[model samples]
Target: MKKYIFLIILMGFTTMGLAQNSVSGTIKNRNNETISNVEISVSDAVIQTKSNEKGQFEIKNLPIGKWILIFKKDKFEIKSEQVSIGNQEQKILDIILENEEHHIDEILVSSVFNKTQNENVVKIDHINLKQIQNAGAINLSDALATNPGVSVVSTGVSIGKPVIRGLSGNRVLTYAQGIRLENQQFGEEHGLGLNANGQESVEIIKGPASLLYGSDAMGGVLYFNPEKYAANNKTELAVNQVVNSNTQGSNSSVTVKASEEKFKFLVQNNYTTHADYKTPNGETVVNTRFIEKDFKIGTSFATSRYVADFRYNYNDLNLGLPEEEIEDSRFRTPLFPSQKIENHLLSFNQKVFFKNSKLEATAGYVFNDRKELESIDEIALFMKLKTFNYNVRYYLPDFGKFETIIGFQGMNQENRNFGEERLIPNAKIADIGFFGTSQYKFNKNLLQFGVRYDFRNVTIQEFGEFGTEGSFQKLDKNFESINASFGFKTEITEKITTRINVATGFRAPNLSELSSNGVHEGSNRYEIGNPNLKNEQNFQVDLNVDYNAEHFDFFANGFYNNINNYIFISPNGNTIDDNFVYDYLQNNAVLFGGETGIHLHLHEIDWLHMTSSYEIVIGQLNNNSSLPLLPANQWKNNFRANFDVSKNIKNSFIFLQANYTFNQNNISQFETKTNDYLLLSSGIGTDIQMNKSKFNLYLTATNLLNKEYVAHLSRLKADGIYNMGRNIVLGVNFDL
Candidate 1:
């Protein structure tokens, strides 16, 4: 594989590139008024340019094919136009944009059809780069947890599990570089191995996406889009640096990219290290430090009828488990009882364009090595997971108002243990799924539906001596399911839009859930697996409504999920070796919740913006007992202002945010209640231009009031550990 990647890179560099195609356009507003400084970009390509003072823009050196041109600017409704680059040397176009009432919608590629939010039947949230930076999130999980209906289950400040609604651990799926991320996600201590540096943006499918991504997507999907290559016939070098006050941490990265008319290449390297985090009482949390190193490379080649993309990423991480002891000295390296993980991912994607149809295929491989250390030289637990996955899709020709797609997805996986301690047996897994989906549009209504069939097989090998603490039973299980989804979107009026979606999803038991027979060190409990556990299946209904006016926008969303044979772990009222014994069980469950928000842009004070949102979720079993690991209800508010300090400084903003988590009293039998708490945050950022170069500077402060509290979903809560307090971050980014 490494040799192949090198060969591809060599081919890309040696091939002579073509630069004949070109596109030129002019922008105008509703009254035929010229609009200047409008950003223009071509979809699936790195070509970009801005309209000049005369509202005229030209982008050169383009591949011959059909492309979508996107136009975006402040206070304007984002627009897209389809353009074809044939044998012609240059293509000219004129565009008109309408004034936006609220926020602009971005084009989404994660969805089957590349459409804007207002044009799709499903409700998808787009998180842009600005949002991620303004939030001052140190990791990907922390950035995701800010969205509604999304929460994080954290182990210290390093490892975190993303929970959608009330389901986590294997139920929620994450996709990066056009492939599923497989990193032993069945364990709660496992975190997202991918970094945020090379990502363009994140798209969240807040409901059942199994119809599109197959099994393990029963909860939802987080799609991380990779950054685009450099503009045609251009080379760019960029640097980013960040510093944190509380942990005395520093994060730095460097990126280099170049592109020709037919070939492109990009590379990035990032490193981050942090000392133990401090609490409100001015005491540092013991062994709460971590270090990460990541490297990414991407290359692509394009022609009139064919396009290929290749991406590879490597990550190395070392994290410490928080202990009760408080350390006064600063230590960047982890102590004993720490975790070391390494991940490597490689993906290849290709697309062939026909007269009116297209074929797309993607193949990926993931290698994950995880280890827990008992001392400087002794390894307590070690596991290796390898996965190979592939996907192929055919886009049928659009007929009138109907469009369709057919696809096949499959994967083969293997897991093994290399340490004396065994949490689960060695296992082999296989999966195959086929799906077909269609969309129809007429007048003001859009309808979408899909169906999928999936098969999964799990095989486990017995391990350890008989009648021993680490003994496991041999088992073979096969699970099959047929899932379907339906969605309808309608424009109620010029200012109102509504969406309704119904979907069914399923998940087969993981290896640990089916074969574990020993103590789980993470939770410090003896867990016995149930071989007879059945597949967990669920049906969900979702409804969303949005109202947009001159200066105000409001949205409301609700969902209800009914699950059968839901799997959970509970104490069996027994103890072994002074450790509590827990057994995996199955029961019917239901989860229901809703999220609502309002955004107001003052009509008179155009610079001021205020937004507020509330989110809640409830999960219960057939016996009316609450499910464990559910996040408490939360309410958040933000006030922001935007202005320009001078001509050299543009897109300046400052904001203040407040989050209030309500008390969680509806606890499961094995859990305890949590008290309510409020947190405050603030940030300011601006863009500075010097000659032909641009720089972005920002400062963010989290836990502004130094509030000391523990989140309900925190794994350290059992140890009476509080979250981090009063941290300020300073960031600088520049490109040349």
Candidate 2:
């Protein structure tokens, strides 16, 4: 607690230092046209801002220093200004930002889209491409975990899903290219099939968003898009390879794109094969569970203001359970349950932006298919499950600070699990919803309201033989539920903001929770069906205070979630079938928790920089014990330094980054507590420009200390099994 208080106090003083001065300027081109994206910064802190398309920009929060503002655009002479921020009211920092159109070595694209920040919308940090490239990580989930309100824990290396506040799986909805994956339609054990290599960005909307998405989105929604759409008559290809110290093997991928005015196409291919990844103890935990190959191909067509897209993703992985459970032959023979994933999506988007009346419409179809336990005799196949979503938005900027979005969505899913004694046949479920969202800004105070209604239905077939007959069971019947949200954001000052959003959401039972009848070899558990199930509802409120200044940035957010009818498996007493059996059943409970992060950066020293970030989470089940699989309180302290190696070397620089994670100790039923440990990781990267292409090299070393520690969510069987060991990775980023 003292650590938290001291950090807060230090941040308060930083906020006080933010009230310094302001500067404004105009940037125009050689032809007297306003030039956009002219990088302008004070001193060399990289506090960068760009001129608007009209070449106008504003800067603030100067802490009384001899500041020199530098403005430079590609092919243009670099502009410079030396002035003091010390009580200078007569300072007129105005200059024309020019453009040098003569040096056209290659095509350069600019991002001209207007970015709007509305306090009423509660838009957290925008995970832009720049941030993604700077924060070297293995995947999107690991990258997004840096955000305060979001938490991520892997079911294994192959499965990592984000938890908002304290909700995930059934409570969350992930979107790509305006389409929802709908695979989380089942449960948390299943992983998302997205690769971040060719991704544009991932937006984490952390609140009750069912008003636009439907029942599957009780917690929030995550949006993913392509990095860049190639222009007509152009082609871009990128190849990436990554190696990590924790996992000795390297993963490689390639993405090729060709686009034109009427049509844009992209093809992405990825392959990763790892041997037994070692832990600090020099032993392997997750067996052949490592993945070998995955592929994804996508294409898009745009005309006027309308766009259409299609995508397909496939995964082939040889999976295995923990060494402790190796006695279970079910996973040894059927070739250790080789798993495959196939996903297909199709969608269309149209926009009408005329006058103050703006209309946007989107519709899409998604299919998530998985062949569970396919390598085993008693195969449990989850066939093609489908989902359909649609939305319509109308914006009226002329209405002042008032905006509204409304839409309707419907989803239907089917699952089948077979066995020799009896074929469970299949289970079918559906969700239909209607919702609305409104935002209003008054003075410095902002407000937003949302509401949603969902109808759920589920049916199961209980057959006796392979094709034998049994009475059909309506496990979960038609259920009606509602979700609502209201929030407020207030800018206490030009540099400080406080925001809070309170919402309620609900989720009806899914197929897996209702009629799963066979063994899940991956989890090494034989799951049964539950005929009696109820809807789970939750009401949560989040409070955040953010402060940004000349040399500091900090935010603290707290959330409380009250959940009821939590569908957790109960004790099925005891049962011995053809093989040694485990006991489990189904029951209901309540849950609550919250997550927060605090980051601080020390003043820079020459080419060196120091920064630290801390994250902690606490939660309970029935308001009693901890929530299983919840990420423990941890912290990452990082130090980086970059230096100019030489001038003739051109793009020459060396950077070193080191990070450490603190202890995590929350454990639930049947789970053990894990001890804390430290990790040291470092990386160096550079790029070499060529005549027609570019080559980049990246080398990273992880677990430098070889410290042994186990993540609370690591799929490895208990006893504090070491999770990572010293390893080095080498990769090349080639662009053609």
Candidate 3:
């Protein structure tokens, strides 16, 4: 590890060279008239400038390479263009903006090449902070469910996990602040444990991304981009508040930031408290309340040749377990059978710029403490996890029309338990990987490909027997794998584009799946691990087509995945201390799915918009049996109108939405079918100007029709409990 660290630093220093690049642009309207006061920003760089009265803007001291420029202004659609800069060369660009009547395309930062939405080889979804706030989501998982090809598997409202393409748990990877999150995610009841208040935007990769992020990315990746610092020589402050009726919950947050020419800093704090959520029948689920507190701080320093950033985040959660009956109280304090989780994370990122290339490095450390209580004053289980990760990437000099990247990533983790009940024994894990990827563009067609190799080692400590359960013996395992991918994107016609990709991914068995020999408290079952389990491998193919016209947009995405040695738990027709006995097993499986959507805007009534989307997925074992916890087919439709109530009340809009979930009869033998249901919801939002401050106000209603329904993926469904319903939310945000 020390040698690797030294090598990375040496490479950064050796690649240093001197170069000066500048970009100048003129912004105009559809009528070819120069427009002023447009905000222009360069991607992955700390340069932002506004257009002068002559509609001209210039950014200097930039790296000599390809860059994406974004132009934005009020009442105008956003525009992005790709530009390349040579050493000591001044590039000039002309940009045109249309009226804010059509949906604007966003640039995807998570892609290997930082391509635009229409140019990416794989489908990526973007959800901005503004949209998350408008939806009035209480957690990260709920906020992400608004996008197609995404769903939430929940033990309850406070314990929801993200499911993508019929895969959850360790199959999906979550990244925040450019670091992979590892908080004992092998359990079904483990939530994301991330706060959405301080995030700028969330990007979802819809398919396997093992080439970029080594393991645990077989399903996809959820990248949470932090909010950027204030513009140069500026200071800003903001506060937000939200209230929910169903849970009697309140969320409050505050943020402050300042930036100068060479340095910038930001800080944020958030607090949330809620009571038991109520169902459509006005029945309160016992022990369903939760409380959370979060704090984050970040700072950065930038020079002509180097940039360094440091960030720290702290989160504390008191989540209640909605299992057996307890007190039906509306207080914030959790009752018995609850959980307390505290997480601390620190990360440092560095970038060294050369004349034609750049080197990036990131190091992160995370500490997680989890405690579960079965009695009011006694702890049932306690586990502590500590992880250190490092990543280094070198961008090779631009090769004519090609871009190349070589990277190395590694992680070291330790897990220990100090409780009466041991779900998983003490374990240590280490991983290292090396990969290289490249992109080549010719005319309107782009080609992308990559390959990676990874090695992992795991060691477990033996533990004593518990009651009648067998003892767990010491184990050591080593795994190695190689994966690759190929993709292509092209514009089929002036108004249509298509992308095709094929990728292979793999995952090693988690400690819980290989070491556990007792009853799992979260799932209420006796799970016996398979000590000799092998690694799981998958291969997937994806196809996406998009059509963009003057007044409408349409998209279609399809995917098929095949897996070998897929591990799952099945009942063994036995019981241990009244809990059903389940054994970890492996089988070959196949999953196929697709999502389709369309957005329409009326040309005559520019303020009127309509959207409709449908998604379905099927997961089956080699024996023709359905997989467990598969999401049902769902369809969503929305109608919205935007208008100005008055000069002070600008950007006013109201929307009505409907969600239809079809009956899920395709299930495993241990699962039950869920009935079909339709849910109605609506919301209204507007901007209010008071003195020198602008405030955003929104009101949203969910499950407005009060339909009593249970989602097929809800963990509480087995207990005959319905999901939350008839929720009313009100929120206010403002900058100071």
Candidate 4:
């Protein structure tokens, strides 16, 4: 009788939810123009749109819930509005963009989504809120799979990493709160140093940015930006919950922000836990669980022409793998080590404007540390890693609509490892470097470029047959290398912008590359290192073309990277101390790829809208073998429709979204094989307004049929493992 009662309640809720509703709106620029052909998106949000000609745009089929609307364009101002997709209120609105005056009159979106700034440095790619909310991600990797140039491999539900243009590991640099991330160097068992809960923006610098950000960035860099202020003087808060499609796991997030005339602050926290995720066949593949927490704080003061800003952020991560494989030769196969990592950042800046240019000085430090634990239920594992960074920059107002940016940065890093039974002495390595970047603009055409120089030194304490029992031998090794880069940006026309960038970059050997000793627990691989390694060099070229008009919006980019002295680990034919071991070696390789996105404004109807995007990558190692863990191809599509509620007492909306990822068969030499798969999901929601506060609610189902498949990087595949099962999520948001 109790079970029947619960079922009846569940059925009632399901029936009520299926009674879908919809919402709609129009976006326009200050010229009172429809701003057709412009892209509008929300970050760490749930809404997205494209304005049609006459600068008109709309979103339909939105969950009647509280959500933020973010407006963006290539050369226009950025705007955001808070509103509820209520049960009966029909909303008619337009967005206005001020000319390139440089003064932002609207929302403070993330760094990557900047619209008011003139095109200068590199063209950036983004993963906004609409993408996150509608992509049907049972997990973060599910959404990243939609990005063109990025490929994700997850070791079941707990392990995952982004493969950018065929590059992974240390070659892929990450940025959080404007600082280099330090977690990846720990081991393969670790995922990115960041989670998606509080992220307001994600920017991908697909090529060398070593100038503004010092060494270890030979491949590219990823930037994650969170909200700094609440829209207007209002307070913002929202909670999101999720249940995996294939896994019966649950996750939740709490986001809050407050700002006043003098100062502003915001905070975000997220949590999740799960048992073994299930496949469509109801099979329990692997038992996996993950726990993560992230937060950011910002403070800024404004007075006439003098405005100063400062921010601080902290990120924490812990992942457990149930059945990861232990192949001797593969990178993730043998699994380097299990990792529990913590990342931290502190930033400060001051700026003064003087008609010609704004003078600025910035300073900050970032620290990352990871300690390896034995994966075999508490056995001793060897490797430990950490990275620290510092930076400062000055920007001279545009020399006639142009700005020159000069900056210097410093970095310090250390890697430590000890042998258990081998009783081997510990090894140490130290690195330091400085770099600069500059930009010059002329009318519609802009010139951007930069250069960098880094010095690295490596040392080993005592080796076999060399020093006192516990102390004295030194084979201190030291080497130095110089790295640099340059680029060009041009506005071809009012509707088209193109950029070409060429630069030289490099990554110095870290403790793991030069020498690693100890048992790595998480990844369950015994670690060994080589002392004879050289600094690796890279040369890259990047080209981007963006077209913005009243009817269609498009973006496309191509990139090529050639590396000298590429470092990798492979089986060694010989043995060390009568024990089987592998050595870290360097080689040369080339990587290339491109991504494109398109927005189509259908015949403006009070009831409909649609958009789509795609990305791809290909890479070849020195042996001419395919690079490991590179994504093959990907695509995404979204549609929405609005219902007029003015005729009725209450208003409503309906949204429909679908995403697809083609086969990422691009296998590396070490990878045995990975299969291709696709996923689908949908949801409905609505909103209401009472007093000064707005209330929103919604229900979303992911992996509709509970399809089960292993992400390309799952380590439990041999054990017949699959990812999350079907999941349903309930969400609510409010703003005052």
Candidate 5:
């Protein structure tokens, strides 16, 4: 608590040291015609403004030093320029744009350098939240799964976990509001613990990213960008509502934002509730209901030499464990054997500008309280976790086509138990890492390389009576490793581009894997942990090729990852308390996969578009055995058309999609094979502008044929439970 107060005070002082600066600009097209409503944004800041009727725009409260400005508009090519803010009170500039037909690429801030996807050496996939909502996704994970090379592991419709390239659980990391999210992710049934409300977009890094995010990123990263504040000197309010047919669910949110030249503030409240979901055979799944309540508040302040942003979020969830088969009811309250989780997150980001360089620091604190109930008030299991993490980086001035950055990252976490049953011992974990990376540009080609060293310490406290069932002994462990990454991106020709990267990553054993000594609830398994497990390390190589033309585009991405000291669990042919016993083990593993897709626009019918993609992954151990919990291959196709109905109605569209999952015959020692299945869906949406208020309306129907199919990654697969059946969603949104 003292540390938090000290940091806040420091930021307050820094933000008041100097006066603010401003920038003004004018925008025009190649024909020398003014372009009104063009968006102008600062690359790394949350500040943005639109051009007025005269094609003039101004953004205030900028810090001193260098900044990148991006200009974007429909039917025009995007442009970027770098400018320096010195002693001038305000900088002025004029820009021109060219006509173009391709989609505008957004600036990617997740990378070291604030460059677009096409300009960065690393390959990243960026998806807008509006696009996901237009596709009628019920949750964030389901929306992300629509992208190639991504899948979901689900306990039910309400609980979905993200899986990237056959890696789930703790291997992948999630970031929100410019800080890492920590929410007891070692459990298989643990969900993402985040809502889609107030999110602008998501950027996915599909390979090892230890070079940037340190540990727990052996697989990849999912960075959620929050919705920006209203344009400078603007105040806005929005309301959204959605209803679902399958679960008898309703989702609603309200947001308000106010921005000034030097200060911005926002607040949002979201609520979601659902009853039991029904299958195609008119059978309702028992104890599958859930309710979530979320609240968020943020503020930003800037000066001539310093910028500070602070955000706070509170989330509460009442999730049901679908292990009971009792009578189906439409009650919003969850049944017994349920989970109640409450999470609180606070993030602070500060930037200090120098004459020739800059410094950035970010700090975050998270508190998670989790409880499981056997009855109305009887707590079966409970755990509370607290975490604090920080990152600091120094950006060196550009020198001879070179950009470099050096940083330090660290985290401190503590776990405690307060229930009758304990799954793991009370523990404390500490992590520290140091890294340096640089990017070199030459003739439209980019080369990037980096190295990092990390250390982790784990300390466990003895719990219960030692040498007995469900008892854990005290233990201490330390792990250290060095990792590195290299990448090169270049254009092979005017129409073709290629990117190749090689990176290494490492992960320290999680608490569940190192200290478990009891029967895990809901899984029906007795698990024994390995106290002397070695660190899991991996090296991966990624390749990407893209071809662009007037009427079509094609892209292919492939990767090969080899891991040493990979840890997994297998049955030990023993039973305890009428439950199968499993023992943790280690081995060398390999996973290889790729995604290929092509999109085409009809030349004669300008409004018609078609897209198809295929993704496959194969995971194997050193002994030539298949790995567990791997998703099957998939193929997806989409068709869409955009047209206008009237002058008041704009951007109207209709879409049809089909997805096929291949049969999974390769099974692990304790797994079963899954058959193939196909599903179809469709939707229609349009934007309407009334006299004063703007509105959006959409209707989406999933599982058009009411297919009865089970996915390979479903935890309920063992019980012969199928996925959700035909469902429809009606959504409406309006701005004031």
Candidate 6:
């Protein structure tokens, strides 16, 4: 495993060069004056310091234990505190600063039953980083398809994927910095090859988390949270640009960061290109062009009780495939039933602090390379997936209000195939998991529970030409699972809040559903696989409600799962080279969903704002049919206003949005029936500055009335195409 990830990153930089912890502080305000250059940081270490000019500040090789001390300056009000350090320690503190008016509600760590509670019971959905830089989305499932029971299942515009609530791909599960993202996601045209530039937020867990991430999370989990550095003796630089106009596309990125208090680093690079999109009756669509290149790097080190992190990512893709092209140029090249993907990822994380418990370790590696081509010098399917993952967690020392966690996770996978069609063979996979979770707090409620156990093994290596059903002779498989969960959160009055949860999940049947036999060139069918498919089992129940106030905000969520064998594919009336033959079946299923939202914030027009959301889902089966790539029934709305035309422009806004969708006729069995749409979008933005740099423009449009649609999780909607229409994006971002 790459020399065991380089001997655990050289023993965490040789224990950060013989540790020596330190933390010192002094910032003031609230009329106590003395706040000098502020900016002090230390959460997830990489240290940082500033305060100077008599406001003192010090940060030296820290890592002993709990930490979170952040305080910025410029108009103040970004404060944080939670400190602890020991062993060769030097600690001193005092800080206070508060002035940046309102807007603070963010802190969610993918809640596996409360990470210091910010409301939980398993309903986490956030997407910050300024809403992904004001949604100029071109990836990360198009910025997570604008939240709310998410959806996206494209096969164009750079291949998308992500559809929670009515499953998708390998049953959804993606976690970036905290590992668990093995690339070849059981292909429905792949694509989630990680790159949403150095994200600093995105957390979602809609249902079933398999007792905290095990076995494809049974349709949920998307976490990605990385990007943090540059706060103390900072150094940062940034540049971004994007433009699209219905896929004449473009995107560019660059970022750099540096920090010191105990080392920190970040670097990012991105490049994307697009073409061949257009369709609002204006045709184009041929080949559905795409191209991308991404790069990332991260580093960290600390010392109070040790902390370490390291990350690396590299991706390259060139996908184009919308067969039967009628060529209307704008080519970004990939021609001939194309696809070429390359991904590499590495991760290392560590932490150890014990005074009240804490120990975490993570290791990951993934290298996926897939290729498919049909004509330009034929290749046809080339798969290569290698994954090695590990995780360990412990935090059991808080017995005042009770809290505990224990974990272990594992994976080692391999899949190989080289060209000339081989749908699935050459495989070796192993996984292990063990878990325990707990949390408790009385008074205002909060209670949670957990248990998990899992084990899987798959081994296959056989070739064709012997008694042929595409021959597959050598195979071994074993799967075991057990899962559980329970949760509750309260505070039912003072502006209401509630949550409830129950969970259980599992999935084990992927090697293309246990060893497929032939032809599956990305859904042209002719597949077959089902080594007695069993082990799908899932169960879920969730409910949530909230009602914060200051100027309104509401939410609601609901869920129901239930799966049991559930693994589908269908179509057995036969047809061969001409495609159509499918198999892999198992039944019993059910899915139900809900989401609701409201935001408001008018209070006598304080810069007008409004919001709305709605969603629904229903998957069925146990003979009641319906459930094949489902997703429809949605609603969204927005209004927004907020302005400030002067002071060099400052955070302005203007919005208007509406989305509708609804009309899917619940399909299954060869599915067909789409129809309904309703788009409309708008945008505007601001933030200028000029003397010390800070730009950030924006402009958006998107289908504004050019409507001709087609989306019901469009995998090109079974070949009737039509989905991209009016676009118009434009973006800019700066800081140097």
Query: Model 2: per-residue lDDT, tens digit, 211-329?
Result: 56666566777777555555344688888777755555567888888865456677888776555557777776545455546666766543222234555655554444344454333
Q: Could you tell me the TM-score of candidate 1?
A: 0.94
TM-score of 2: 0.76
Tens-place lDDT digits, model 4, residues 198-267:
6665767677766656566777777777554663344777766665444455667777776554455667
| Model 1 ranges with Cα > 4 A deviation | 1-23, 29-38, 44-67, 84-91, 98-101, 325-330
Backbone clashes for every candidate come to: 0, 6, 0, 54, 0, 8
lDDT of 6 by residue, 488-560 (tens): 8898897778888888888898887877877776677878887888888888888988887777778889888
Candidate 5 structure lDDT: 0.87
- Write model 5 residue lDDT over 1-736, tens digit each, in one string: 5346545644554645465578898899888888997988887887888999989998776777778888887557778877888744689989898765444254655787777677799999888887788788888899999989999998887888899999988899999888888988888776888888988899989989998898889989999988788888989899999999999999999999999877989999999998888888888888889999999999988777777889999999998888755655549888878899999989988888877788888888899998999888799899999988888888999889989999988888999999888887899998889999999999979999999999999999988787677788899899999999999999989888999999999889898889789898857789999898999999999999998777788899999999999999989999988989998899999999999998887678767888899999999999989998888999999998887889789879899999999999877888889999999999999989897578899999999999999899888899998888999999999888
Give the lowest summed-lDDT range of ten residues in model 5. 100-109
lDDT (Cα) of model 3: 0.85
User: In candidate 1, what are the lDDT values of residues 64-105, reduced to their tens digit?
Assistant: 556788898876888888887764358999999997656536
Show model 3 residue runs off by greater than 4 Å: 1-26, 32-37, 46-61, 85-94, 465-470, 690-692
Backbone collision tally, model 2 = 6
What lDDT score is found at residue 162 in candidate 1? 88
The number of the candidate with the highest TM-score is: 5
lDDT of each: 0.85, 0.58, 0.85, 0.58, 0.87, 0.79
Q: Give lDDT: candidate 2, residue 727.
A: 70
lDDT of 3 by residue, 574-610 (tens): 9878999999999999999989999998799888889
